[model samples]
Target: MFSNTPISANHFLIKQLPQATAFIDKNFKVVFVSDKWVEEFNLSTRDIINEHIQDLVGISSKQWENNILRCFKGKRTENFQENYTSIDRETRWLKWNILPWYNENESVIGAIVQAEDITAQISKEQKLEQVQFILKETNEIGKIGHWKYNQSQDIFSSCPMINNLLEIEEDSKLTLDEYIEFYKIGYNRNTLSMAIFSAMENKQSWNEKLEVLTAKGNQRWVNVSGKPLYCNGKYIGIIGIVQDITDYVIKEHQTKSNEHLLKTLINNIPLHIYIKDTQSKKLLANRSELDHCGISNEADIIGKDDFDIYDKELAQKYRDEDLEVMISQTPMINKELSQENSDGTTNYFLSSKIPLKGPNGETTGLVGITMDISDIKQKEKDLRNLIKVSSEQNKKLLNFAHIISHNLRSHSANFSMLLEFLIEEKEEAERQKIFGMLTDSSNNLMETLHTLNDIVTINSESTTNKKEVYLNKQVHKTLKHLNPLLEENNATVITAIPLGTSLQVIPSYLDNMLIQIISNSIKYKKPNVRPEIKLSLSYVQNYTVLSIEDNGIGLDMKKYGEKLFGMYKTFHEHNDAKGLGLYIVKNQIEAMNGKINAQSQVNVGTTINLYFNEEN
Candidate 1:
């Protein structure tokens, strides 16, 4: 009954506490032990309760007792980190929190000791510290920097790499302004300023390449990226990383300079230079093309295709030619092409196109050079025409020689026969008539010689002599020169000319050509109607077209078309119609590398079209 009392029950219940609790007497003996202590040590509570403290725990007896005695001497201590070897000989770290206890009279009795296992936490912290040291060392070796700016404090903090990158001492302090001042001139400062402003005002991030002057007075290129930090929609500051890229920057600049030098060399040449994209039909043309096409501004023609600036047929022809060059993967030289402009002007070109190959030896696009050859083409045409004219003249001269020889032989024969007849018959009238026939035949031979001399003179003049002549003024002058004849024929002349229509031609030949046409129009006036002649001139394509139409007794072209321009062959019986006018007109036009064609009907009218090449 005494053991089962409430006091004993209370003592048993107190002994069942979850923690390791114990009561030690003045002799340092364990007087009471909780169930937790017994279970943790694998000892019976009754057995440990009566054991001495030094014997219960298997640590060094002196060190263990000293720690317990020190706690009981009115001293309090907590978390004295220590290591203990477990039963398995594995070392474990522990923290001991020991507190001294006392009675109400403040006399020290014993202590409460709490031990916490801290091995895992301590090992984790050690590994993390090692990793951080490695990262710092790597940043220093790589010359990379991490930086942060605090707007609230208006301060900047940088890692060791930043100090090394700027060639500043390790202990040096740097501000944002000082950092900005390190940037080299031009884009560096501007880019940095823009980036900072954007982050501050617009909350934008930026990545840029910049040039900076280090403290050692050397210029360096760096790639920098800055991002703004925000907390609760409030702007904090910016953090950024910078990498040294000076070698890459220098290489890139050199490459760009080389490209520009190549482009300049290409542009300086006389050829029309152009570049095309491989996948797209985009083109970049040089200055030569702009000038050749009469374009004043580069923007006006940039990014435009051939169809945008040239005639439809001509553009299609250009595309087809380019496509062939691209597909064949062959370089073409001196390829002849004709291009018509938006104004209907045609240009002859000798072009060369070379495929632009890529690193894989595949055709990427094409580079082309075109040389204007209108002059060359015209010269070739003139040479051919000269050959034709020479052959025709040679034929005519041979025919004239035969006719002269035959005439001379016939005349001598006839003279001999006449003399024999005169001597035999002795008729005075018949002899005199025979002599007169002989004289007439001699005069005809003399006239043929004079005509031949004139033909030679006409053929001897040079064709290429050119001089600037105003068309309107030349027309007026020609009309004035033929005013008397025009007035005599009762002709009404009408003229329609736009201003500033000037041309490059041989002035004398042009005047002669105009005079002949105008005079012929008047000379062939109809019987009943007063001759009305209209003269007009305008530019068409690259050539100037001059038209002369007359209300006259026109010819039946079907009957005499082939002989219209035959030398010394007259169509009309007019005294001035030596047939040489049209012949000379045709020759002069041909010599000047121009063209002339006539349209006529029996009773309607005649119109002659003259086309002249434009001057460069």
Candidate 2:
């Protein structure tokens, strides 16, 4: 203790001190102070000597005061840190040290006090605490954790977050092998093992998405990354991070599955489905559309427009329609259209198109579907033709009914007159004559009945199955039957029908028809000229035409063309003309789904052409 020491010596010693320091007497008055003390307290050029410690520090605390008193009793006291107000009235932290000074007799004389301004250090520590807190919260929220592996010691260390992510207790410490067990078996485990090994051996870094099983047996996806650690160019350990990515991975998988399902549905649909961009270029096409466009691969049709696959005019039309739909933001539903093919056949389609919109409701493109309706069109046409045929048949039935009524009435009138004459006769000869007339009338009525029966039979049996018949053979058979008539008319018959000229027809009908027509040609021959008849065969489209031409007294076609094939219609006056031969022929031909027409010139010739369906 410098009780006898010069104050100047004490000042010299304290001034040499490199820390904020002060020396005080037992009465708690400062004896000398260091330059550091002045600088730390922000003091101007003024003396602070002989000042009480409380006055210099400007803080009133019983504990601080008691510590100073204890220092005077030869006890040393130290405060690591203390909060106090400075001379400027700003709050600050300080570290204090107090010790009793010793005299030559080893008795305590005064205390030496030292203080350190630690405000900056305290502020730094507080900032560090705040950063640590933020980091912990971030880890919990992001499902992230960090880990390190010490290669030399074979030790693996991880943060508490890792345990939480693995669904294990916070205090659980797992060995290297045990930690690996958390990775899902098979590919996930193998991948992590390989990545770690490679990182250590090659000093590389790796990042991978892998599956893991938690301690509670829950499946999860995780992103794992590792980098080899080095210290002084020597491999020390591996440091890495792991993040829970289950939600993200699952959402991605679901999106992929939905896309696949949509693609399959579109491709399997029967309609031709296609998608186009705002520029009217192909963006997507289903399998049905690819097949329709004769494309084997989907990629081949990408970016193509209608002009690439269709005629110029049709392509332009299609593009125009697409533009209209997109611009109007409207849907064209089930529009019927016809397309003519290169083969000169027409196909029908039912097409629909709708504009596609973006998220902001702007028109982005268009989607279209076209269905082939060619089969449906054919069915409609067949239905119309059937209705027309039914109407024509009804008209024919009405005409037949009128013809039957008129013919039956005539027969009945004749019978009545003959019976009256027989009843009024007075002599036997007269009675016999009336009876003969009655018999003749009865015969004529019976013949008319037979004719009616023939007509009825032809109509009823129209749908009978037909057999193949050769035209030349049938014509010869008919001529042989009509040889006597031909001889009477001195007719020269020429059979121009080719051999093997076959037709599917009712054999009996053809035979009867040939007899009626050829006989008429012979009966109506020019009075002075010999009759000449020619039978020829030809084809027109799906019909096989058989022409029977005759050089005889032809009828006036212009005058009687309307009733050429009408029942009970005769163009010329003749006793043998029953006005039934051509009508019967026409009915027979039609029953076999054939047609009949005549070209004639008076006194020149008549050609009766029969058209049979070659397809049948």
Candidate 3:
């Protein structure tokens, strides 16, 4: 059916061939190329006729060229597949079938080669390999095992990995009943049984996650899936796969538990907690923060910003601070902040803000907590006020003692001079007059000593043995004792002290001080004016202040106001004007942790104010 001529001589006939065919000589030179080869592989017969195959194909793998060599030496067909990147940078595939050609001398001269475009085929084959690899890897990673249960024999055929998945002995195949026992009874076993029955009766497939217990008494979670197998319209068996999911299940449960705990702690605590999105400007505020913002529902506040709830200025300020937090990406700790409330009041807080980070350590947003500090700030203010009052008391106490010493020295000098005069006199009448002068001087010295001792006693007692003392009753007792003196001066004491007036103070000191101050008004009355005193008690700024007004010869306050309470500094001309009375009054009030102030005008009147601290 063929000619005995060399295949190289039939080049003219090869041009009419339908398949892509090329003939190469023993020396690997191209002998012929069919018209189909030129059209299919894009080759030129004239250009490649006498050229070496290496020069035309431009193939670099010398070892891969062995197919051509084998065909050149033998009268046989060689099949090969080749892939390479083309000029357009796409991968091209070719399947080559090379057959040796013979000459009339019965010797192989060249080979006829046929090439087919197989790019799509090779691409599909590669994809299949990749899918297989993925499936195998998934099964291994998930610790999956496959099984088939034959209903006829009530037996299960399991993969090698099933023993590991179920924690059973190696190489041991279990019966269907034994495998069912591995499922934790109650819910887990019942579910599996129902699923199996559903698959058999309703032709349904099941994919469920459930718990299991092994022979070794270890519990685990498993992902199970099965499909029922049927033959001749009758249920035959079931086939399925299983995966151990204990670690994944446990981890998921723990994560949810931790989230619940954090939610409880955040909502229940007193601090205002919040989280904010850096870009969207959305806020997630906890329960305490919601209450602070006067919002009742979480849904109402979610996805909202400060602008939604606060005034424009406050919202802008809040956003600017958020920007600062994002830029710094560090903790902003213990910054004092004040926020205005809906009721026109302001609340203070010690706020701390910190940035939230992503998995790659990039700043994502910010979280903050604010502790209310208004009460602490109020306490601090009260402490400062108390310190100021204590300092003023110490300064006046020093000045008060110095004035008392001066008065003592003046009285002692007068006593020494009078005594010396009495001792030197010799005449009987003169001696008698000197004795009377000595007696007056001794009484004055004794009075000075008693006043000085009272001042010392006032300074020594710091804390009072506090008790409720009735003010009106004490005033009554003093007035009764001074009735004789009041009668001699034709004085009237009009008291506005509430009938049930009461205070917390030392009883004896309050009684003595009240007597001295009340009598002083009577003693210092103007020469022509009747002795009139009005005493009243009322509350002023948490203090019970007693006011004693008298139509007395008041001194010029512009001249003596500064030393009005100075010991031995007398403003009025009176036989009993020692001026120690008011000084001693100041000390007694200080001992009770109270205050006294006197207001006077030129011979008009006097008002003595005694301030007793109370829950007025």
Candidate 4:
């Protein structure tokens, strides 16, 4: 100790520190180890200090050991990774740094080394790489990209695909404001801003579609979604994704435009139109419907249920029908409906309701249209009435034919029997009496046949003979023709004819009609009482009114009201009362576009009013 002790120089002096360290001696034995090495190997320093390096670290592979031995033989090696087994029989990764050591005379002594357990770090790196690879594959397949925003830093970042979707350069850096500016100028910006704000402020998530202007000045559609990250009630910036959807957007717009055009065309049609939901009894109507209901605008009726807008009973009936259509899942065409509106007016509609179906052919709703049919309905009613009248007339004609045949055959048979009896008898007196009776009967039969032929002709001919004639002059002519009868009945004819009163009529028919009517009045004059007949004509809009009032044996209209104009229907049993007069008069007047009606009582008098079309 007195003299400088000879230093037993060893490369293990630097390598055998307390921290993780390793050493190789001149003979390449692991002669030194640190505390971490001792713990790692599950051995004492005394046990591993003098062991060969391969045995200490359990490097059983010859190839790996050769590399380590070569490194120890003066070849400097740094950060070499290899698998090694600890004393506990657990294998793990270890990294070693190796350097050759030398003595003062520059002779190679051994090598110094440092080792670190890096199994956890290497495993984490491998897992991260795998996750990144999977995310790349998913992004490519889905055509989606993730994006992030940092509010505090005012920075926006997106994955590469997002930039591609927006047609932006890969290396472009965008702020949130700049990114929002890329949205189209109209509703797209508003919708996107609302979605983003809701997500960031309320810690919510939203998905929406928006149009964006791309770098190439082309517009594109994209589906965007975002979710806010909140920590302790404080909102962090949003993370989201965007997907290109330009094709879908264009298709949707085209479909909507077509639908709108269809609706517009339907609204412009001049008919009542409406639609209804299948299950709910509600009406969706158009502008024409508003006009039909006498309302100024759609707001007057829109959203009001059928019960509120229509009569309760009618609404219920309509709802029941719609329910049936929906249940049957069929189309109903030209179904007639009589509906009452809110204003207490009724309308006729020809309706068609079709079931709206889902992809599976299940009924989801109903679409209905109603066309205004009020005018058509009116025309149909008129046609039915005409048919009824024609049927009645046919029956009357049949009855008339039977009467004529029976009367004629009865008279002929009587005449033939009388002649046969005359042939059988020889008395000249009896023969002459039979002859007189036969003559009277033959005369009566001939008169009846003539009347029947005249009626048949009048009925068969068309009643459209139209011409302009002065009604006042016709009345004066009729009165003049009846002057002799009036004189014999002590009748007084007073006329009150307005100047220029005329009507559309057949000239000859009108004269005959007036003659017949005036003759009847004078013929049925009260006996021992002077008959006073008043004839007055006045002009009304579209018509000339002729009123003939008589003071005579008034008719009992209650008994012979409907038969007044019927052939062979005589109200008076007078010798000259043919009953054909009024019948012919009515037929002639009606044929000339005129109408005649009578009001009478048993004792008072009769007033006959005739309306004729005013000459155009």
Best candidate per lDDT, number?
A: 2
Write candidate 3's Cα lDDT for 534-599 as tens digits.
998878887899998898988788899888887778976678787778888888887787889989
Against the reference, the lDDT scores of all candidates come to 0.76, 0.87, 0.80, 0.76
lDDT of 1 by residue, 15-55 (tens): 78766666665576665666766665556633665467656
Top-scoring candidate (TM-score): 3
**TM-scores for every predicted model:** 0.35, 0.60, 0.64, 0.49
The residue pairs that clash in candidate 2, if any, are: 1-102, 1-103
- lDDT for 14 in candidate 2 is 76
Model 2 quality (TM-score): 0.60
lDDT of 1 at 348: 93
lDDT: worst 10-residue window of model 3? 1-10
What is candidate 4's TM-score against the reference?
0.49
TM-score of 3: 0.64
Candidates 1 and 4: which is better by lDDT?
Answer: 1
- Candidate 3 lDDT score at position 425: 72
Of models 3 and 4, which has the larger TM-score? 3
Error of 1 at 581 (Å): 2.2
